[model samples]
Target: MNKKGESKLTIVITVFAILIILVLSFLFYYYAVKSMSFSRSETASLSGYADNAGRKESAGLRTNVIIFKPSEVLPQQQKEGYCFSTSVADPFRQDAFRCQVENEIFDPCFTTEEQGIVFCQINPLAPEAFLIKLEKPLPKASLLEFTQDNWAWFVKLEDKTYCSPFTGTRPFFSQDQIAYYGCKSNNIEEQIVLIGDLMIDDIWTANKAVLIKEKDNWAIKFLEQIKIDSVWQ
Candidate 1:
């Protein structure tokens, strides 16, 4: 009721209010940091291994070691032969393998529009085969025309077209085969998209190529083989 009593009361209230604010702030910061650390650990764990379904295809599955990217955004800044961290949470649960194609040499920043996928085929009698899925898609006409134009260089042995329609758990087929999947619109026939091996040179190194949009035109650039320690099923 006195003046001194009133002043003391006001000071106590102010101090309590400041203490409450400080406690709330500390709690908020603690939780935020904890959530972030957990998220990063989960991401790293996922990146360490391939999908269970993918692992089923082959028995001796080993982790493919390459420079792993923190995430899949801005593939342009990434290096070839590197595996992106975004692999685990993907629909296919596959890692993105970066391989240097011819066009990439000219423009190192050129990257896939979507997440690229990589896998391997198991063959007991033969060497390991790899499959590379490109994020970019080409129309049926464009693919056919490109194949026809480069028939001499693309087709070897018996001039057999090395492409097939893929509609399975995997996003794209083998690197040696042209994977025809996806459609631009409802009419799948008209807008059928093409991916996978865009080109295979019979000459020189027999380099495998993928289609990349350069300026206004689509260019076929060859990719050199990046030998990984293990084959991802």
Candidate 2:
């Protein structure tokens, strides 16, 4: 082969190799940036989730709860961590045995930030109705307030009255401004905000990371030591 032709072929091959390297580098950087952006978005979302969980736990007012001190946040971003999580991956799956109870409206949720215990009143209307005592010092007695006539207790959002049969939730659980769904014939699901962040410029400020991503059930579980009973008395 001619020396000139061989030199030209070598140059072409080198150029091709360089182009391939550049393309690969660009793609790698693009994906890396995308991953970073996703991480930030998730952090913000989880932060908000955690915040809502705190509020719900406070507003619940179920029973036997100690005051919770919010985690210390420095004036500057000195601390970066997740707080106030029940930490239960999924608490409402079948086979979840929970001791059921009834009580005054209370916040019975536990987060990792506070402790490893989750406490709350379990609605008896569930297929396997039982109280969920996730926190320490289980309920000594039961709060069975169900009746044959009423399947579940819920506050009516429309008229905000008919407090004749208060069963599960508080009548004035939240103000009129907050929107929620409730049914007279069943346990009204407040759809309470159990987790969240301070949304600032579409970015979460204070973060609460709830990593739960199950589609079928909730985060409340039954007690392993407890079972269902037709009569709570």
Candidate 3:
């Protein structure tokens, strides 16, 4: 080939290579952003699943409003009521009721049998709170002790299986005459696990639990249990 023609051919090849590199880089960036967006949306939806469940329970009951600081202990007066429902906003009307104490803001509160009034300040340490009603009311001390000891088991069961459990929140269960505890393990991933007869399905974004009394002690059974096929494996 002539020297001029050879030079032109080399220039064209170099430009083509650069164009391919640019296109590849753009594609990579696009997919990375898309993946991140999907992750965030999934997380939000999972969180909303738990919150919405609580709201649904709250709507059915005649609830009262109470307010207290998270830093302080749950007042003895409010201890009698079971927190069947919770919310980030004031479920009551704008002027319905307000917290009497200073720095006591309503982040999440509960509905109880007594006057339906209860309040709690938002605690960063324990962000998630659950409403658990037992089929039979056990002594307050025994219920607290039993739950405290078995909380680790619950955490392991929830996360180790298919569901991804939320962390940092202290486990608290309220005692009432109502049968069955409405406890759930929030799942981040979309998967299913089977524990014995129970099937933990992430389609609901949470796993429900069923407690059975065995003579002297109580046992917790997740409606959905361990993963049959784990991704870690």
Top candidate when judged by TM-score against the true structure:
2
Which portions of model 2 miss their true places by more than 4 Å?
A: 62-233
Q: Which 10-residue window in model 1 sums to the lowest lDDT? A: 151-160
Query: Which model, 1 or 2, shows the larger lDDT?
Result: 1
> Candidate 1 — what's its lDDT?
0.35
Positional deviation of residue 7's Cα in model 2 after best superposition, in angstroms: 1.0
Model 3 per-residue lDDT tens digits across residues 47-143: 8998999898766432111222333343443323232222312322221122223333333343334244444423322444322232223222211
* Number of backbone collisions per candidate: 1, 33, 7
Q: Can you give the lDDT of residue 72 in candidate 2?
A: 39
Extract clashing residue pairs from model 1: 81-98
lDDT, residue 162, candidate 2? 18
- TM for every model, in the order presented, reads 0.25, 0.27, 0.25
Alpha carbon lDDT of each predicted model? 0.35, 0.32, 0.36
Q: Which residues of candidate 1, in runs, are more than 4 Å off?
A: 51-233
> For candidate 1, lDDT tens digit of each residue in 1-233?
99999999999999999999999999999999999999999987786555654566454433232222233332233222323222211112222222323343110111233445333222212343333344443211111122122211011112211222232333332455553322223432222234433233322112333444555444444434321222111
lDDT of 2 by residue, 169-228 (tens): 422322332211222323343222212211222111212111222354333222111111
